[model samples]
Target: MSDIGRTSAVALVGVRGTLVEVEAHLTSQLPTFSIIGLPDTSLGEARERVRSAATVADCPLPSRRITVNLTPASVPKRGSGFDLAIAMAVLAAAGTAPGADRRTVYVGELGLDGRVRPVLGIIPVVLAARDAGVDRVVLPVGNLAEAQAVPGVTLTGVDSLRSAAIDAGADLPAGFVEPVLLPVPSDDTPPPLELADVVGNATGVRAVITAAAGGHHVLLLGPPGAGKTMLAERLPALLPDLDTDAALEVAAVRSVAGHGVRSWTHRPPWEAPHHSASAAALIGGGSAQLRPGAVSRATRGVLFLDEATEFPRVVLDALRQPLEAGRITVHRAGGSAEFPARCQLVLAANPCPCGNAGTVGGPACTCPPSAVRRYLGRLSGPLLDRIDIRVAVARVTTGTLRASDGTAPTTDAARRSIGDARERMRSRLRGTGWTTNADVTGAWLRSDGRAAPGASDLLDRALDLGTLTMRGWDRVMRLAWTIADLDGDDRPDRRHVERALALRMAL
Candidate 1:
């Protein structure tokens, strides 16, 4: 047989960019192994691990000069995920390792003693391979569940390189067992805080419901313990379960970030980053290769910012682009990387330095009006205009707090109502390519002018009164359509427009 041999393919695990392919070649020469293609430190070390794993698996090491090339050499590859693929490719090219089928993509990290270890982002990588017409995939035994989540792809799990080599038509090693799929466990529990426990903040509750129904951005101004965080946490529960495409998108992001969903159920994701989080952490970035950040991880979900005013102005301001474009671009020395950041933003902040600034009960306000203005002024007008609903939360009274005699509606009840409203909105925007009111542009909103007659007149009046800017008018009109949709109306009416305007002015 000819000594010159090559085996090459790609592996991808993220939607932020294209798939990554790995290629390997072997030739008769000095016994040296080299890996190319912009591999990071971890990937560069795969040469040693692959050789030891092959030896332990009873596969003869190639006594030749081996060169492995990962295509698109400019893109930096991280993690040990390429270990198994690289090793298999080397062995196949050396005419030793088993199962050299080009239709199957192998992904896993191999230990020196021949054990296969799980790696992150297997789900998206396998899905990408399947979409690219690859018929089968072999992954670490531990990652089979995640890989199996994607249908129509033949998934095989291997515990050691020995079994893989044997399956590939090589000599079998002793004490090798076929890998089996592990059963994934399920944990179903209700959310911690129910809307009924929120006591009396009827206006706040209404705003929360409306925001949830239309996937609108919300801002909550209240004291430290005014239930703002509680309301924000429950918003995710109010959102309808994610559809298939959205679920896949969310799963892909989590996988790339080395996290996985506990269950395959398509519940909306919730992400609440602390006030001290950096701009890079909120958006996404790293040294060599960029990774998904909180916003990208929370795509098609909710991102709650607590203690909003405490965050650095620069960090908070970085959100403007994503808020407007539904995506974030991280510029680097080599090039720019983009990530999806389309999410419902809920910001909770204290009213003033003392946090007791407009509340009826509490210590006397010591903060000057200038301090209060400065605190609130940190929020830019453009950012505030992007937010659809703004409500001030107030403390609940003792009687209202104690009156929860199981008579009030549970979160499930609220969720059902919100779910119905969301379905209605989705039906209305089926072919419009819009998922929520906040996503609708000015042109689209104006196109349906005659559809909602009084909406235009009311918006014009608000603009004339200087109560709303041009951008604010469009956002408020969008909110009006959302309100109408929540009320099961075909189009926004004068009442819906008035309610939306009222919510906007409440800030």
Candidate 2:
């Protein structure tokens, strides 16, 4: 005779979770134990950990043929999160208690001493559980805060297998649940970086503002000391706070990366990768498990690529799809996982090998013309076309530096302006799934007739003159809308289109 016990669990396919059922079977046969169904090495070792944990917690497993299976066998299971569920299922099958409980989720790694350890991706797993109609979740005490961040769900944090089994209505050793507090720094928070230090490059600063307002990508080209890096650094300060849904998404990415939320600010993330970063480091691919790359971490944020010309062509080209689709899928021999990557791409580069091309120091540029072509050629036209704002930053002169512009707005003021513009966009785009001008499709703009007087004629002239591709034309229109929103215009007109074209064509 054989007895069966069941419970539910979760596995992170990417930044999302796929529900998995844990089934435990016990039979009166030759004493042995095994785990079937597709499981990575991490999940395979869970058996030893769970058995030892159950024994230490005074709920010993029967010395018989014991088997555990993760249903939907074709789906590859990774991580050690299934430990609790497996242990509970086995105990129930042994007639120890009602261990294999339903209407809930069990996700935690088991230790040799029966301690329930925290695992990666608590937020996404909990979000998936809520979506799957599971209301209660049993997580490690350390993951309580992140699990609590998801509303409308009952959370029970346990310190060990003993506590978890008891809470699940199992007849096991009773113990008090020790609440694990999230880590907090002892030092006071430091003051924020100021944006006003970046003098000169007023055009670049304005372009940053426009990009912040619409979530459009930007490309900056200039010699050194032109404030390219400084401008990019200040962009996050200009961006407004993220809403609940966006914060949750960002937190999910952070959790999967094993990076705790050091400072839980709603500010958009900024990731500036070195030019030598590999395709997998920037775009995310691995041997067995796919990971979140710089692009994925920059979701709803800025991904600044400095010294853009030095990066490998293939690595840079990998960004094209995610830019268009707002997500990326990493397909390996084992499986594929899709991660959201709707980040604003910011590319900064020098004009030539000498970093002085096309500037006042142009006469001193030592690189040959062939070398220059080879340098700038790395950025393909197709990739550059997706960028909405392309500006040439120039080094500031002494005279410009001495003059004080006290009336210039600081980061807070610029953020207020961006926030107001975003609000206006949301009002117009309500129920449309687009919150900013950059995300609005050209077809929607044309169909809704938001383009103003003499706009099409100007766009048509640019297209005929071979200055803009079909994609570039649409991007220009979107940038124009962002500009109009900043200037408090309800519709984009010829002036906005002209300025947008100027920014886009300067490259």
Candidate 3:
């Protein structure tokens, strides 16, 4: 009888589940290794790479017929992350390696030249492994930093198949060395853009501060030279640092997208896609596999759309779903993939084609009222309804320029205020599962019944006069809460409500 044995391991096809098992068997037949599974080209080729890697590592190759079967073979495997796993299984079956059943997951792409290459989605993969009671994971050296981001998992980085084999006791290479900690990248702090740099637009600055505090979406309609882009860039300065969970979410998106996850500590991402961005680029759609688009990458951060009106209607409409659901689902021939997209939207657009629709100092407007209406008409009412703040930015005047002294607080001051406001809101809505005012539903807003007496009357009048939709009414109430929180008030008062309404109707 031929001596036969099997070793087990796992591989991640997508972000969905933990590794599928790869069973390696050696039998009495012509020397040949065959891989049986629904594997893509990259995965199927792992057989040849593993053989060469073992040879380079000076490990003995089985002279008998070798066959590898990936169990639950119905599911597809797409990457070379299975190379190390397959190699380990082969060694274990030959009685060359030890610790084959201690729940150790391996993930890495093997280069034909025996180098371990980085693979995508390492963060999520390691996290899944850690959660599934897997005590340790062996990943490509380049991916060690990302794998380290996940706590509770003992991560070992391998440089080549030979190094990995020596660690597993498969074959003792000439110079076997212990695993070294991957060098961590030095932290680079982004220079802060101060609110004091803005010449005027005190009201606009305050509105942005409120948006940061409550996670509200804002639209800025202004003529040329109104500093719309400048203001949008400064919004991140007012935002609080990303929390631990939010930081991981942002890092995961970047990791899978092949962008290295630097520091997830306090950085807030800011994505400013050009107006020419396609629908797929904005909302994430591709042929076979759906990759994350700009909106998805902007999760838990800011998505600034400058010249928002210039974008196609289709692209603009795609944002509505993610904006409401905090995530987007992209369906394709293979399957659907969902990406987190909870972001603070900041849209800046010129008032009209002439860029002088309502400016005080500008050339005479030749476009008719119909054209102006059509220009703004591109933005649907439903979309406008979702935006909580609509402020009109005016061109800076001579007086405003003179007042651009350092008298006002800097960006640090505004950031502190935003932090304080967020803490207050989080405490109040702690048990309610609401993170910010923008996340509170209309029912919750009304149920609270904490609105000021005169403010309720004003809100009722707006609803009665058709000035506010049901959604708009809720957003106004949310804004009132944010304003009150900023002013250190325990409850929203009439002045806060009035100010909120004024900011909403600024455009």
Best by TM-score: 2
Q: What lDDT tens digits, residue by residue, belong to model 3 across residues 1-507?
A: 243334334544334445667677888789998888777777788888988877777775688788888877887666777788888878877777765533678777766667777777777677668767888888888888776877887988888877777677754755543343334444433456888887788777877889999999999999888888888888887888887878877877766666655634457888899999998889887764467888988888899999898887778888988999998988877767778899999999988888888888667677789888878877778888889999999888887777765455578888888889999999999898788999988888777736866676788898999988888888899999999999999889889988999999998
Worst 10 residues of 2 by lDDT: 182-191
- Could you report the Cα RMSD, in angstroms, for every candidate shown? 3.2, 2.4, 3.1
Candidate 1 lDDT score relative to the true structure: 0.77
lDDT, candidates in the order shown:
0.77, 0.84, 0.79
lDDT of prediction 3:
0.79
lDDT of candidate 1 over 147-181, digit per residue (tens): 67778888888888876676677766556644433
Q: Over all chains combined, what TM-score does candidate 1 have?
A: 0.91
Query: Over 4 Å off in model 3, which ranges?
Result: 1-17, 30-32, 175-190, 261-263, 403-407
lDDT-wise, the better of 1 and 2 is: 2
Better of 2 and 3 by TM-score: 2
- TM-score of decoy 3: 0.91
How many residue pairs clash in each candidate at the backbone level?
4, 0, 0
Q: TM-score for every candidate vs. truth?
A: 0.91, 0.95, 0.91
lDDT of 2 by residue, 344-400 (tens): 999999999889888883358888999999999999888998999999998777755
Q: Candidate 3, after superposition: displacement of residue 37 in Å?
A: 4.3
